[model samples]
Target: MKVGFIQFSPILGKPTQTLERLEYLIDKGKHSDILVLPELCNSGYAFNSRQQALNSSESVADSKFIRFLHEKSNKYNLYIVSGFCEKSDKDLYNSSFLVGPNEYIEVYRKSHLFLNEKDFFSPGNTDYSVYDIGICKIGMLICFDWVFPEAWRILALKGADIICHPSNIVLPDLCQKTIPGHSICNRMFIVTANRIGTEDNLTFTGSSIICDPRGNILTQASDDQEEVMISDIDLNLARDKSITSRNHIFLDRRPDKYLDIAKAIEESV
Candidate 1:
């Protein structure tokens, strides 16, 4: 399958300009099976206040950006995973959703919010979800969720061949370096779509990457450029978790000894 990411800077509060920029990039890129986009591409990040974020966001069903994406999905006849600022009822969320040909599939709200994001959006309550789209099984996770190994492991256990990470990262090189470790452990392909440019006091680190199951960097973008990073990955590489024929990534597990891990989290929360 063709796996890739689109890296670009989103203009804060200018959804029209940002959407147009994204559309231009998509049109110019090579055809791919699935593509991932940066976090909050529509509404942008680093809001001055919660009210400003809400003003920039709208209900998913009513969002023009989403409508435009729906149109583009059919135009390109490919799957798209993108980050969006979502407004639901009176609460707001930093969320990501999947768009298939002529339809909107599912949404994953950002479970772990970064600095300043906690002041604006509600914590995500959704569980880890994986979708089988015939070609391959795919999963979604937002920016800060990259820090949690358990989250990535859960998706791998759920049979996700590829994990789409939509991020607007600020801390330089931390996630870019750590993701390959996650891919090696889980035996799954990972596409990390990160944005560039500064919003207010924060400067986003680009370096969007695609890593194979063997911990090889298939393709990587520059830390501060607009680029389309793509790689042709074999789905069978992710499905096979065998390390040395005798040892398996999943079969070698010692879950019995890890019960304390769950207990530790319960005590802290």
Candidate 2:
């Protein structure tokens, strides 16, 4: 099936303008099976103050914007994933959602909150989620979650053929060094959508990309530019590749030595 990734332009705290552009993308993506977007793509990252960030937050349960996402997903007969700030009575979470044609399927609150995000956002209590989308079983992580292998490893071990990561990695060399290694080691297709343009002093370079299970860059965007990439990936092939000699490195693990690692770290904390 074909998947699309949108490296959208930063709107600088304007969800209305961002939604306008996103509507355009949804209209244009009628032919794709799934459409993905970058982290904080709906409302630009506003970290100047806690009150400002809190004011920008929206509830996933009652958001009209989320309703529109469901509409678009059903209209196009596609699966949708995007990153935004989620507000609940308890706390705010940097969250991502997966909406299928039928309903909103799953939501993942980011576990690794970035520097200032820790000040305003609560870390996710649950682990990553895996879902069956058409013929593919997919997993999700948002932004900084990719820096930790445990996030992807958990999904990979859970039988995900593809891992979708919505991010805003601005550093060129850091993204260059990290992305390929993660794709190669995980032996699963990595679909990443990053953002572009200047928001609050941070300049995002939207090198959004997709990698095959073997770590080959199938499609990549130019630095600091807005673009959409669509590519056909056979989920069956990735599943088969995971067990092949070329991708066997992912399974050659020492799980016995790493029992309860996530819980152990939580206990120590």
Candidate 3:
């Protein structure tokens, strides 16, 4: 499977401009099986209050933009994973949709909402969900959720080979040092697509990246540039890696010791 990560600066408060950028990339990278975009790529992370997000939010059912995204997936014969401000049942959500060629396959809402995000968006309730795409079990999660080991563990235990993360992470130190180690720790492919440019005084230095199960950085987008990072992944390779590896970091966990630690915490709390 060939995955393409679209890293770009989102125009503040303009979904039309963002859609246009996405369309251009889809046309350019016609060979990609899956095109991944950043978290809140549509809304530009402009959250003044809950009322502001609510005002800017769009309905998934009635949104012509979302319908156009679905159309683009079918037209290009690619799986489209894009982020948007979703307004469902009077609650606002920072959400990403995994859109197949035919329909929306699954939706992963941002679980660990960032600073000022908790004020505007509701945190996602589910752990992690996996979808079967071709020969691989693909899992999707959002930005801050990647910091939690439990999220990836759930996906890995459920038999996910690839974990796609749609994020807005800036800072070279965090991306270069911290995030890559996640792939190594979990023993799963990590495909992270992040945003770029200044939105509401926050400047995003895009470093969208894809890492193999061995924590090798396959490809990464340069900071402060609009670019797409593509990498070819063989599904069989992941299975081979999982089965052939004898010294996995996750497999050597002392669960019995951890359980006692958890029990001690519960008693203390």
Candidate achieving the largest lDDT? 1
Which pairs, if any, clash in model 2?
A: none
Candidate 2 TM-score, C-alpha based: 0.91
| lDDT computed for candidate 2 | 0.78
Q: Please list the C-alpha lDDT of all candidates, in the order they appear.
A: 0.91, 0.78, 0.77
Model 1, stretches more than 4 Å misplaced?
264-269
- Candidate achieving higher TM-score, 1 or 3: 1
For candidate 3, write residues 166-200 as lDDT tens digits.
88875444754666777776677878888888767
Top TM-score prediction, candidate number:
1
Model 1, range 87-193, lDDT digits (tens) per residue? Answer: 99998999999888867568999999998999999999788999998899999999899999999999999999999999999999999999999999999999999
What is the C-alpha lDDT profile of model 2 across 62-116, one tens digit per residue? 7766788899999888888888778889688888888888775688888998777
What pairs collide in candidate 1?
A: none
Give the worst 10-residue stretch by lDDT in candidate 3: 236-245
Task: Compute the lDDT for candidate 3.
Answer: 0.77
Give each model a TM-score: 0.97, 0.91, 0.90
Question: For candidate 2, which ten residues in a row score worst on lDDT?
Answer: 241-250
User: CA lDDT of 97 in candidate 2?
Assistant: 83
